[model samples]
Target: MGDTGESQIKSGQGYPVLKPVGDSAICIEFGDEINDRVNDLVYSAADALNARSPSWLRELVPTYRSLLVHYDALAADYDEVRSDLLGLAASDSAAETSSSGGARQVFELPTVYGGEFGPDLDAVASHAGLDSEDVVRIHSSIAYRVYMIGFAPGFPYLGGMDQSIATPRLATPRTRVPAGSVGIAESQTGVYPAASPGGWQLIGQTPVQLFDAQAQPPSVLQPGHFVKFVPVDESEFQRIQAEVANGQYRVAHSEFAS
Candidate 1:
């Protein structure tokens, strides 16, 4: 079914649409924008689908506004899978997962703002009409939400930056941004999962390994997780970095009743 529709429930405010991506996949769209209201439904539906998984279902990839479902082409039929998804979208079970789909994990990412790590901190501060220190205060004040992980592996796409300090992305992207680099692009801020090319204005750097190949989850952050940037002294940053590199540090994180 390549049709778009909205849920007829007040608690669930998703303007969801179901469409076929190919012969073996279906994408469930929940609004066409990136907002928490839409994210709730996306994750909730993921939980609902995972809870009662079809034998032929393969993987679920949740994005800003949609969930991509991949299935075994040999074992599954598109029409039947689409029908099952339609039934889910029209039911309250999919809507109810907004709160209980998964416990919202909170992570305290220790960052070293400014200096050699964050070369563009001063520029961002100047752009925002604030001093570098004040900029750090504003950036670290709030607990940002992990909207969706994309761009690079373990690279978290976070939201909820203070509008006052919002700065545009750099005119030309850096050829290589270090892993654990924390940057602000307009109203959103995120950590660089690896040393990759990016245009986001760099504000700080963290020692935490956002992605570890040998780690259980590989990616430290996941969608719906809450993150707070904890500013640390240069000495502390060095210490933590050493600890991390030596495999002696555990990234400080907790789970809340989200």
Candidate 2:
């Protein structure tokens, strides 16, 4: 009757707060800053809300630390939806709110680190006070966790990078960065889902397409997914590129116990 199930958990300072994003939408902010815990909260709430697709809820757009909840005014007014959101916020059932318990998919991205594909690799290493090899070693060593998808179709917001590799963006952005370009910014890394203007310091590029509207899941990556970058040589890059052009290359997939 009262939007039943776990509606009594204590919320931390990182609690979700609703704010008007537009006349028809409200943004539930999980954190004021960009961090993994906060992002997990955003995605958790969005995923749970989306699982049911309740009549009043129209859309759930999850971002780095916030989720945009769009509703139909005719079916449900602002107060009705806001109350429902508060119920979700207070839910205490671990089975319902735990981020780690949710579904996840893994994607393996092959990258050619340094050289023409990644013009900024050297600069990023230099900025971080590490040699090129050290940069690659640190980068390829960690499995990044996907927090959300935005900026472009299929573009994933990934977390879990080695803080030591954090490098500031270039003073100026490139006009066109090829799709599947892997790059680091501050404490995060992400793949450029398509050839587009971007400012993240690129360390490599993968031939696999990240966003294909033709596929069942347009974006190969999504929130709660895991990603890893496997380094490849230039020849391998050419081979994969050719395969992709010939429509034979498929983004490698595997199951994550997580």
Candidate 3:
């Protein structure tokens, strides 16, 4: 669809700022804070934009509250592209605060908490005035929303963490955090996805490969997905790891309309 197409989506709350990024890109800021409602709008806008992308539209990157769109400066004029995007931002369907185009999948991820895998678990618990088991119980109880997939390949920036067990990041960044490590920083908790240097407080580890370069889409999770942690023992962790390596393990997920 071109910029002249009728807007089918309803308008959302707040005004979107269309800011230019350097020479070849634009960043559409939806809001400031990290929230589900705002992200839904971003997701919808991205879905709608990509669906009816102009020839100048190069790449669309959706984040917590903005959509970074890169255009071909050589093939298209920036002002024309800007006007087209402005038209999209003004569209009712794009303005609608919904992720209609994105498919949301609920994942039940198996994780092993404490001991060597979760070195900072006890320390974090002690700081929170609670035991390690209480920390695990509380952490695993909530179904976290995947706000965005960034940092490492499939590393999720998850929201909906329990306020009770909230903890800050490590003062000193670790040289290397192993892949599959689950960590919490302030009000957020997320998996490591891959081994990398990180500062988030480590709490657990998962055997599931969050990102597989050889896989069709690579990343296992997406922005609209909800992740549920299923605590598993060390033995089960080992078994799952082996199964995954042998390509016999299936990651359990369910599809439901949001």
Candidate 4:
């Protein structure tokens, strides 16, 4: 989409900044920082737009602190759409949508830390000035929020990792990191959904299949969801792997107030 000459527009105080992202899309920025409150606004905007069900609406892509709205330029006037977006942004419903305490799905991922599966576990532990066992305990202690799914298919960019175990990425990225490999890079922790080159510190590996082409809504993880790592033994990992391969395993999940 080519950039339209439309200048940035603000709906007023507390509302998002709407900027034209080419001729067919608009970037609705909620805030300048990456945090839960800003993310909630992004989700709220998306929810409000979807509820309106405008014919011109094509897709709503929610990012860390903004919502990208794609529209059918031929069917709808840009000014009208912009006005509608501003109206929604300033409405009480939009604020209420975000403030409503709703349940968010939390997936429990069983992981096996260290050994062959996690080649960089020792390096990570050494960097953190702690033992491998302590590293594992600290890593799995809290539930992480899935900020956005990108970089690779079903790959979740997670947040809320304890800074104590934070480690930098590999000096030289591996040519190929195995799928289901859980890695820590700086303050973020995420799982490699498929076999691909990556640089995150490999501390653990989960047996869950993150992406399955044959299944409906292939990606097991979704944006705005939570992931809780459950450390498992080698035997348990093997059992879960076998079950996953046979299409019998179901990732343990529950709902918690967001």
Per-candidate TM-scores read 0.90, 0.86, 0.90, 0.91
Q: Model 2, range 44-133, lDDT digits (tens) per residue?
A: 787778776779888888887788999987888888888888887787345245665655667788999998888889998898899999
* Candidate 1: 10-residue stretch with minimal lDDT: 1-10
lDDT of 3 by residue, 1-258 (tens): 111112212123345778889889989877765667667778888888878978888898899878899999987777887899888877746346445555568898999999999999998898899999999999999778887888668888898888888898999999999999999899889999888999989999999998989997888887878998989999999999999899788889987676
Least lDDT summed over 10 consecutive residues: which range in candidate 4?
Answer: 1-10
Model 3: how far residue 155 lies from native, Å: 1.4
Cα RMSD to native, each candidate?
Answer: 4.4, 5.6, 5.8, 5.9
| Model 3 TM-score, all chains together | 0.90
List clashing residue pairs in candidate 2.
6-91
Off by over 4 Å in 4: 1-15, 92-100
What is candidate 3's CA lDDT for residue 60?
87
- How accurate locally, in lDDT, is each candidate? 0.84, 0.79, 0.84, 0.85
| Candidate 3 local distance difference test against the native | 0.84
Per-model clash counts, in order, read 0, 1, 3, 0
